[model samples]
Target: MSKFWSETVKRCVPYVPGEQLNDANIVKLNTNENPYPPSPKVVEAIKVEAERKLNLYPSPTVDQLRTDIAEYYGLSKDNIFVGNGSDEVLAFSFLAFFEAGKPIRFPAVSYSFYPVYCKLFNISYEEVKLNRDFTLPVEAFFQTDGGVIFPNPNAPTSIYLEIDAIKEIVENNPDQVVIIDEAYIDFASESAVSLINTYNNLLVIQTMSKSRSLAGLRIGFALGNSDLIEGLTRIKDSFNSYTLDRLAIAGAEAAIKDTNYYKSTTREIIHTREWITAEMKKRGFHILPSQANFIFVSHYNKQAEELYAALKDRNVLIRHFNKPGIDNYLRVTIGTNKNMELFLNKLDEILA
Candidate 1:
């Protein structure tokens, strides 16, 4: 507790992202980053923008990019909100909608970021427990003191709750906002984006980092009713009117518009996730039912930390959370075929 530390800093419990080891030889499956590169269009768009507009500031409203994203999702620009990344969008959402006195609700085992955001914003919250099987208990999220926010697939567990269940939560919380963090939805079966037009309180947040393979570009967006979008926009403009720079805006625009590239990459990741799930099961790991570009699993006999440590020693890294209830599990990102083959081979060696 330094004297210089503000109350916010003192209360904040920061989120620990996946380890980013710089070893070229490592097979990284800890972070759920796409195993592919951004589309050629994304590359070309970024280059063109860089040459033409390095001297000019990016559009604060981000109109063209928002319009492009809306067209892709069959919504209007007014229904969209773009930020530096989904993390920023989420931060703005907490400040814009959730109040400090009214505690919001989210799954206990959900995105690690939710609690951190709650702490940073000084917003009170309740951690709704997930089912024993790691699925979200929709009934428990109903009629919250504040609003509701949770990942669609409920991170680390990677168990997707259907939209019908999501609708019930939204309908029940009619007076408050219900934010769905769909960072992994592109890899999943469906998105709750369809519910935005139907529910004024629904906000579906997504990122171009994963499926779009632009993790370096730092782009994320939110889809919601125009009012919710406006609220987020007000918060964003208050903080940084130009949250996304010119390069990021151009790259994100191309990423959103190139539907064909996203489809092919997304399909490949899904295929890889399925194959890896089956293989892990055969190896005696209890794999969770994942609809994302990653799989959550636990070896029947191996400790998660021990496996994690052993893999890191061999330059094959995956994620292991130390928090209870999920301390035994590991989250493995679906890499390219060759990368997965290497990961499996390394696992075999470690098991042997």
Candidate 2:
């Protein structure tokens, strides 16, 4: 507690990222990162850019990457914006669109960063409780006058809502900004980007960190109407004109363009997730139907913290959040098939 800290700084509670342990032999599945390595094309692109452009700043607009994303998603460059990471993009969004005095609304069970962002920006917010089964309730959002945000296939719980349900919420509240954080949308059935043409207030945020296997490069983007993108751009330009380095821009563009590689990897991960879910259910664990690259499960007989400790002792790590309703569950990332088999075997041993 330094006396030099400003009042606003003292009040801020930063988001905690998942642990990245250095133990080489550990089966790391805590973070919801892609288990496969990034496409070889991404590495080649970075190498080419690194050789020639160490002295110059990256394109401030990130025009080429923006155009690539726009073309991929069938949107205009005016509707897309990029940032250092989805977290920064989210920060800019909270500052630019959700600072109104009205209380912002989101799911009680969602990405943990939402509360941190609200506190960091000093915006008043209320949690609209998820339904009895952890699904988002469309009616819970109808009474609110403020902005709305929630992750699709909502995190920690890994439950997904249909696109029609999301459109109902957005169309119902056309006046307020409704942000859909889709960091795991690639694994889901549908994306909110499809609704952007109809709902001007809809802002869909995504990141390369999850599906594209580029978390190390730190690239993320937002898709919305031109006006909303402009607002985010204003906040970003005022903060850092060159949030992405040259290598990042090059690598991300390459990754986005490598459609075959990205699709193949995601398919494999989804397959692994299904197998893992079936096996866990056989072991008497209640597993949520997940559309993301992770599964949320809890056993009726074993405590989550106790299982987490046992797994850690065996050098296999998974995420266990001690938050109120979800304290008994473990959120396990979909790892390679071999890794998952090892995890299940170790769990059987620990339980025995």
Candidate 3:
């Protein structure tokens, strides 16, 4: 309520990120972070880069890292754009593509950050409701006034929409930009990145924080038609030239190049997710069919808030959204097998 606050600053309702407790003993499953450490190659690359270039500014164009990501995704460096994280990339997209009066469209229960970004940018938006089963209504996103954006396997729900469905949405909205945030696509069945070569209006943004076990390293990128890449580049250049540091560029390049380690760790997380789903269902939780590394679920009898508090008391943390219609559901990241076992044991004690 101070005169120092601008109208924009006063209007801002910032996104509340998952709790980052400092307790080393806490089993954190709230944020969908990889339980494993970043690949040894990523660490080595960072160490090498850190020793050589802490004083010099990073590449504003981020040429080599963009090249590495493009090579991995079978695209050209011109088709890629890198930023601090997908959140920043998304923020730039909202400014670059979506307009103030012309409202954009996203799922009513999709990633919470989408609405926050819309508010911050003063872009009007419509939240098209998902189907009762939590699947995206592809037609609802068609012919949007401004543009469209949503996570593929939507956040908190963890239900994946197929690429064919995605293609349909893109095809339907020929004039509008369709941004697909694929932060969890590595753990999923497939990626919409395959469709970008054919659809000029599609932009697929991804992060290294989840599947690559580099949450501590703030790196995210986008792949699309070279034009969209240029648009994001314009927005980025207008603000800051170097969104990625030297160490981040090197580590991200290494993470992109280390495909084998990424595959093994992603496979393990999928396996853990499968077993955890079964275990939770056996204990009366209604689980979504998750292709991502986390599970969205609700207990048959227990309240989500109560369960969340009980788990926190046991030193195990999971996410519980306080929003309407999903206040009873919790989103749990799939951890190591031993971690899941310990979580299950803690839950049994609470439920018993």
The predicted structure with the larger lDDT, 2 or 3, is 3
- Judge candidate 2 at residue 95 and give its lDDT: 93
Model 2 lDDT tens row, 119-173? 8888889998888789898877764678799999799888888988888888877
Off by over 4 Å in 3: none
Clashing pairs in 2: none
Predicted structure 1: lDDT: 0.92
Q: Candidate 3's residue-wise lDDT over 1-352, tens digit each?
A: 8999988888878999999999999999999999999999999999998899689898899999999999988999999999998889989999989988999999999889998998888989999988989899888888888889999789989999998899989998899999999999988888999998899999999999999999899998999999999999999999999899999999999999999999999999999999999999999999999999999999989999999999999999999999988999999999999999999999999889
Model 1: per-residue Cα lDDT at residue 167:
96
Which residue segments of model 1 deviate by more than 4 Å?
Answer: none
Error of 2 at 53 (Å): 1.2
lDDT of 1 by residue, 158-231 (tens): 88889999999999998999999999999888899998889999999999999999888999999999999999
Predicted structure 1, TM vs. truth: 0.99
Q: Report model 3's TM-score to 2 decimal places.
A: 0.99
